[model samples]
Target: MRYCLGLDMPGDAALIAEYENWHTDIWPEVRKSILDSGIVNMEIYRLENRLFMIMEVGPDFSFDRKAAMDAANPAVQRWEELMWKYQVAIPGGKPGEKWRLMDRIFSLQEAL
Candidate 1:
């Protein structure tokens, strides 16, 4: 029910500043869209343009459909286009896959 993704920063300082400003308070509707999508917890962290997001959803969470719906929504699409100006994937990244899934090496919970 939890997922993580990372995004790199843009090379330009001015653009990076702009991006930070936007994130300081993202669009309200965007926030609503996410909350309505069955997400239980979500947060984003940044270390000099290297951004990481952690999201926890219900057992029925479906990123595939949610992603496609987001792509079709004009506001969301616009936001994504603008965001792309500040992010990119590393070499060997799969096509259409931006944030790579990280393996969980350790956890506090014990397997039943």
Candidate 2:
């Protein structure tokens, strides 16, 4: 399955640069945790302070399960804490939520 999400980053140029730098070399532990949680592929894109993420996952993937795994992993928690320094909840997001799920409004597949 594929999932799409959105996040907001600080508009500061320096902070945005630092955020991109971190993604250039994500920690091994974080990557492992994602794969182990059933994610097959993930990509993040940025347009100014708005960030979009696309994730393709295995059949066993569950957002709730992934959240639980991340909460229990020290490295994942650390990474999230560091990332939160430059992230903010977008409008209408739930309290304490960083990434918000995006709704798919149109798909070309349906036209075929």
Candidate 3:
């Protein structure tokens, strides 16, 4: 399965630079946690202060399971805390939500 999500930065150049730097070398444990949660591939892209993430997951993946695993992992917790410094919840997001799942309104393949 594939999912797309959105997030935002504060539009500060310095903060954006720092956030990009952190992704250049994600902590070992955080990477491990991601793989363990059944995420087969992931990529993040940025356009100014807006950010998008694409995630491909295996059949066993579930958001509830991943959330529980992340909650139990100290490294994931720490990483999330650090990321929150640079991330802002999207306008319609629930309180404390960092990434908002995006709704796909169109697919070229489906149209074809």
Candidate 4:
């Protein structure tokens, strides 16, 4: 299923620049973890400090499964830790939630 979510980066100007650099090509290990967790497609967009992401997850998507896989892979865990250094949860957002899912409001594809 396709999922839409949003997150935010640190608002500091310098930090935002650095975050942009890192996203130029995310860590390869991180990509492996996501793919191993059943994320078939992913993309991220930004507007100033706000970030939006779209991911196509498999039917078996499960947070616990992903978490467990991440925990088992130290390289992936380390990558996540490093990435988190630059990212901050969206203001007034849930503590552990990085990307908040968006509800589907309109979709022409839905009718197809």
| Model 4 regions lying over 4 Å from their true place | none
Candidate 2 lDDT tens digits, 1-112:
8999999998999999999999999999999999999999999999999999999999999999999999999999999999999898899987899999999998899877
lDDT values, one for every candidate: 0.77, 0.96, 0.96, 0.83
Model 2: residues with Cα > 4 Å off, grouped in runs: none
Q: TM-scores for all candidates?
A: 0.83, 0.97, 0.98, 0.82
- For residues 1-112, what per-residue lDDT tens digits would candidate 1 score against the true structure? 8888777777778888888889899888677667767778888887876878899998767888678678777887788777777777755677756666666767768653
Error of 4 at 63 (Å): 2.4
Task: Please give the ranking of all candidate structures by TM-score, highest first, separated by commas.
Answer: 3, 2, 1, 4
Candidate 3 residue-wise lDDT, 14-76, digit = tens: 999999999999999999999999999999999999999999999999999999999999999
Q: lDDT per residue, candidate 4, 1-112, as tens digits?
A: 8888888788788988887788788788888889989999999898888888999999888878987998899888787777787778866666776767788899998877
Q: What is the lDDT of residue 10 in candidate 2?
A: 87
Better of 3 and 4 by TM-score: 3
Better by TM-score, candidate 2 or 1: 2
